[model samples]
Target: MLDQNTSAQLKTLLERLESPIEIVATLNGSDKSDKIKELVTEVAALSPQVTARFDGTNKRAPSFGIAKVGEQPRVNFAGLPMGHEFTSLILALLQVSGYAPKVSDEVLAQIKGLNLTSDFDVFVSLSCHNCPDVVQALNLIAIYNPDTTATMIDGAFFQDEVEERKIMAVPMLFQNGEHIGQGRMTLEEIIAKLDTGAAAKDAEKLNAKESFDVLVIGGGPAGNTSAIYAARKGIKTGIVAERFGGQVMDTMDIENYTSIQKTQGPKFAAEMEAHVREYGVDIMNLQKVSSIKGADETANGLVEVTLENGAKLESKTVILSTGARWREMNVPGEKEYKTRGVAYCPHCDGPLFKGKRVAVIGGGNSGVEAAIDLAGIVEHVTLVEFDTKLRADQVLQDKLNSLPNTTVIMNALSTEVVGDGSQVTALKYKDRATDEEHTVELAGIFVQIGLLPNTDFLKDSPVELSKRGEIVINERNETNVKGVFAAGDCTTVPYKQIIIATGEGAKASLSAFDYIIRSGQ
Candidate 1:
């Protein structure tokens, strides 16, 4: 039961409520407990102005049903209602009840088709928040793109997935075919690549496949470093990506990435790309790599690279830097209107939704970052998560709470994305506490939940795979497959950072050179 202090706090929060609010009752093991009933009644009495109901089976939760105000507001609670729990629940209620919450329509337009298909995934690091702009940008795009939904998985949380995808850096994206793209890209840039240009969309898919000296698949920090190193070493290096900048680009500010104290993912990615140009590396942006197969060992040990565009190439070594993807809510209409109101990658698309209202999925660090970032870029930022509490550290949680424009909702799952062909206008989610469903109006959505690996390209290969699906490699950065070296997020490198990737890339180059020399290539 909530103490007087807690109940009083809830009452105080309700005073500002202009709309209806849901207050589901907490469910306990007891089926015939009067205590639960009394608790529910007490809570309702405390916030008579706001709505209060029970959790599972008509039992009273502190806050469950939507209020009867002008707008029905709903807040969810998955677990028992206690300490600091009410804060999250209460905030969600207020957000759902209110309208126009100081958000901009332009920003809302950017995030129209979020909650689309479960195709898109974004990965991010803790230390890579550039003024919270990265999260804002992603929130805008997630609102619109439904076929390719967006999510921000924790770089450290998904260890097995990271290893499997060889993710050695933060802020990456993983799409279907296990093809990964890293770096910071604007919504326009991301959509352009995913849309499939003339070559990739209309051409015949390559079955046999070709190869390259350094076919750095994926364009995250690790892949970027691999390309830079390969190019610098005078080897034929090519960076193929759905777009550039990988997941790092999704991060607005990067304080932990070495050399640069504070840098946005997009800027960092552009600089890295520029540096690679100095070394003459081939950057195949907006290209799709479909399959991979081995070639007969030539005297020069040539590898083949086949593209979805029917283009092919040959090289001596291959570097796999394919990244990861984000998890989804698996709700209705999520796949129907992608990119219309739904988005991921707050940094790339947040500006488009400036002064607009948006919703963020997930309660982890990435979600926290998104809310904080979007608060600055958009008029109002709504953070939604199924977890009972935020998974982010205390400092991050505190920062999120302090943001005036940010409202966090816990113990809720989006059930449907309501909108038409052009964009998303509202969101419907289920309250885990009371099992009641409610809908709220919003312009955009951003998903920052979790990640999935992008290693489908290596399924048939002889490269030794770990149980987690990451490529097994020695400290030297050479893969079990000869002349086929892997590095960056594509390898099971211990650390994921720009500096670390640069070192690994350098190490990989040296190893590749040694193999070439020993084989007399």
Candidate 2:
């Protein structure tokens, strides 16, 4: 049910509609269908022009078939529009009511000019913050093109559909029953994808099984540097990465990357890719390294890196530049409220909580940095740390303290994320020093605890790892195993900065070259 203020706002917004909007919900007597019908009815009752009808006997089981009245429905939703996805539902209603597309004129013109009869089936969860961006973008395109139909499939209510599609993440898109990419993307990016038709082609096969003089795992700054160094030596080089940008894609600001005064993560990632592509390095993106074997001379000497999809790459030497990711707090309600109110990347989701109070759970440099960056966008930031003192740099701490909207609370451990059924509302924490419990009422939570190396694939390998699970390496970037090396935050590098990682990657490539020369590979 809508509150008085929300109902008033909806009424006002509906008054702008020049035509009637009809929503037909197909139900199958499930609890999810009941909730969907209730929500649609509640929202439709706010305006005279808006109407909702429910059908309980439909064989579709549970889904919303929405379209303008007196026309065949072109849109379908399989889940309840709750959490951040409620915005998508509202936008769908508004668009059906004759709201103009929010995309640029160029994009709309390109979409309108499209001759392909496209069907976009988007899968999303209710709590996904990134889902609405993709849904709205696709819906706007559908509004522009009469031949295009956009469908929103809820990942929750349609568990079978999710499993069938092998969907591991939200915002997974499909074009005419073929799987596209995942995650939120801009309209321009989507259009470029459609124009290129790369996903449809690339999804069929990754690459031919090829051998390289040196192979670099991961695709961050370190991996790119390693590939370039190897390729420059006139050696057959290949770089296989899960994502081309690695963890660097999530980074919003970079000021200490040597000469660059300022750069965003995606921009830097694109630059790195462009630079790497200039060489003959056989770059394989979107492949996960499952395991490594036979690095020793006694066992064929060639290192074979196996992928999750049963593909393998053989190389004389392998450099592990797999990066690190943000550590999770692993508290209660964390998973349930993810993207609803519990968010990890401040740069990606901060704009959604504009003028809303939020909490940052950490006191390290990353935490303070997130707080500082979010302070300008959000109304207030409550920084919670388990340590008695903040571990961030003095400059960052000073900047954070200078902000009147920021509050630093030391010796506090985040215990749980509290939220309503639809969205997050507050955060619960415990004071380690006083043994007292406290709660902060906020709209969102930004977690920047620390870094965790993505090195689980090396657990069974002979490459020695530190107690902290980081690959142990010498100054020359050489691991204990022969012809195997590592770099970046995943290694025992003293400083986990991008510049240091890049240098280490270069050194690792040189070391691999030296090993190759000595071993006569």
Candidate 3:
């Protein structure tokens, strides 16, 4: 049901519709479908120009076909567009009603010049905040170019398509049936993909041994800084990463980055990318490292990095800066409700649940801190801890105790997430002491247990890793393996902040340079 305030806002926005837009929907009579239909009807009621037609007989549940009245329907919503995806739905309606997307003339010209047919099938969920950006960008391109078509497919509704593609993440892009990109991508990046058929065109499998003075294995803050520092020293530098921004791209607020009062993750990532690209470093984005061989194991007497795409590159020194990712609870409904309600990033998804009750699982520093931050925005917060007492600092516990809307539930084990087919509704847990099961009815659940280092790929290698899987590095960011260094959250660094990672990256690069000078290689 649309609130009074939201209904008024939608009514105001819908007045901008220049032409009549017909929304043809396919509903399977499910609860989610009924809700979607009601929502669409409510939007249609706001304006006589906007109307909706339903097809309840269609086998594909929770799907809708949208188009202008005179032209063919070129857009489809595979699931109910709620949460952040509602923006995409509204943008689609506006675009179909004859409003042009806000794209530059130069980009339009470049899009017009393309002879190839670009078909983009973007997989997204309703709760993903980053999906709308990618969808809107692609849809804008499609609107400007006759040869391009962009379709937003809801991952939850399109189970067959999702299973066939093995999509585990949102904002996954498929170009002409090939999985081209995943996660949030800029418009410039999509244009680049259109120009080059492959996601990592610059990282095509190398046939012969190509050596570099330094090779950075990740593209996070640490790896990018390492590459920039090494390139500034006039060395042959190369960086291979699954993604350019690493975990920093998922971060929403960055206040303690030194000097900067406030910044977001994506913006900081772009700045870092621009800074690194200013140097002569060869960067291979979206390339996953399959295995690595130390300098002694390589036949060419150089450390070798093998990519999942069968690319091989050798370097005198290798710096591993693969950052850490949020640890999953591995419980039922955790994976299914991901983004919809079971969110790992509090900063990124906190705003979506404003004024709604939510739970923060884990009573550690991150969990308690996230609870404190969310209590101010949300109606109420339930902090659940598995331990007998909160493991956070005393100061943080005291701060949490002061929040009026915050409820601390100690010695509770989260069992599962309770939700309908469309969205999350509540969380199921059990008391550790009494073994009494309880359910907390809430709109969202933020999991802040801990982080796991992204060094599983190095397990087969000779790289020395702690029992917890973090790479062990010395003060100079030098790993036990000769000519191979590690830094950032992936390493056993004392601090995992951005500033510390940047400093460690610089130290690793300088150490590599010193080793090269001493070895005369």
Candidate 4:
């Protein structure tokens, strides 16, 4: 129910939004083309007060925030007005349409009802595209309560700044400017982080939160395995993952991992997570490590992991299963609306989309594989390829073609993904030949692009990352850095498979144990 005051504010915002918003379309470094002028006129007519203008001043790279200077707003005219930013425009509309800086009673009430009003900052990188959903949820809280402001900064773009803050991974959250948690978190954990009560923290014994016996940085097969092992070994472990399952989470069917003929990706992830939980692992979901600084080893020879959370954790051993993320289109909205409708793994969220329509954006083996799998669940699967022909293996291509609900859109380029918040609605495509335009209504879009290692955080750390972003190590999966061992998709190994990651996990554990013995600990 809307309060009278809140309703009035929303209505006023709606009026301002309906009153013509200005957007200018311009081609950078080009002569003043008539097309630019015509489009600017079209945008001006949409907003009563907003006017479109193009200046040749050539704006600097993206600044901290959008700057407005005098009557003329800094002009950046993107020609064709298409692609990822399309949704950004929509978001701007909604934010303004519902704008009431002071917020409403229900929201205000929720704020007053919070366990804590302290602010938490989460820093993330574009590489960790799986994080937008987490950031958005935090942003929602910040909306209702101005005391907390959760903002996401591109770690790569602001590498120096992130380093200053000691950020090692993406989606890492800070609690009251302190390190409250890391990795994946249940709703309960989230509320705990939001907890302002004194009793709960005392019961939870957060006084020991600053110390860890083992710090496991990946939530995939290896990291999960290590966490379970460490917890059983009676060493408190903190597992940090951008998303709990890493690249494997993006994978569909897992017939390779031991003990199961075949299983869904997320189910496997959940099981691994369960195994760790049964042993009481301190797992922080959606947690990204921004940086790692170590204190002197304890008397027992445990390495201390000091994360960007401003908390110092004493861990005897650190496992590097930090894993990798899918390679993206590098377009705008891809980063903004990743989990909303744009997904990476088909199997994890595929079942929830039964009978819905969707599209797959790659033509490689993974792309074809995703389309074929999605066809079984979704009503229709449109496979869009930018290249002239499919690049997947002939066998996979044949399988994709055999699927009834799958349609191949070759020689097409996906210029834009349009959606209405909660889910994706349409995808705009363009042809390279006759310049034909195409659009398809899709409920979900899975990107079968590729992957990159999450090693940007190990910059000055002792860990040695491979050229391809995999952690460089010896035959035992041990890195050049002492007391550091890496495994899984982020390692310098060929053939990315679940079984391989698990094997490496066992190997890494054994090696770590051996390292401990050799030191006479």
Q: For each candidate, give its TM-score against the true structure.
A: 0.55, 0.66, 0.69, 0.54
Candidate 2 vs candidate 4, TM-score winner: 2
lDDT of 4 by residue, 207-300 (tens): 3676565678888988887777666666556787656766665454677666798986656787787788888788765455666543332454
Candidate 1 residue spans exceeding 4 A from truth: 1-213, 231-236, 295-301, 325-328, 347-357, 376-380, 420-422, 431-438, 460-472, 494-496
Question: Which of 2 and 4 is ahead in lDDT?
Answer: 2
Q: For candidate 1, lDDT tens digit of each residue in 1-521? A: 77888778877876777755555454455532345455556666776565555543422222233333442222222223232223334544454455323334633443442333434455554444421222233333433443433334443444445545544333456664364455444554544454444355334333333444667777777777777766776767777776577766555567886566897666787787777768777676666676654434444457666666677656677766666556566787666544446777675455445566889988888888878877887899888889788998899999988888888788997889888555678889989999999887886788787665566667777777777567778887777776767666556776555677667767776777677667775
Which residue window of length 10 is worst by lDDT in model 3? Answer: 198-207
Q: What is the per-residue lDDT of model 3 for residues 1-521, given as tens digits with 9 covering 90 to 100?
A: 78899889888888888799887777776887887788778888888888788853333567675667765455666677777777877888788787866665866666656555677788886766567778887776776665666778876667666655555456778878887876677665677667654434445645353689999999999999999999999999988878788888887678998899999787798899889989967877767899999888877778988888677888999999999999988888988877567777665466556678999999998899999988987899999999989999999999999999999999899999988865678999999899999999998889999889999999998999999999998898888888899989999987789999999999999999998999889
Tens digits of lDDT, candidate 2, 59-84: 35577755677755555666776666
Ranking by TM-score: 3, 2, 1, 4
Residue runs of model 2 more than 4 Å from their true location after superposition: 1-207, 297-299
RMSD of each: 19.4, 11.6, 8.2, 16.6
Number of the top TM-score candidate? 3
By descending lDDT, how would the candidates be arranged? 3, 2, 4, 1
lDDT of each: 0.61, 0.80, 0.81, 0.61
Error of 3 at 377 (Å): 6.1
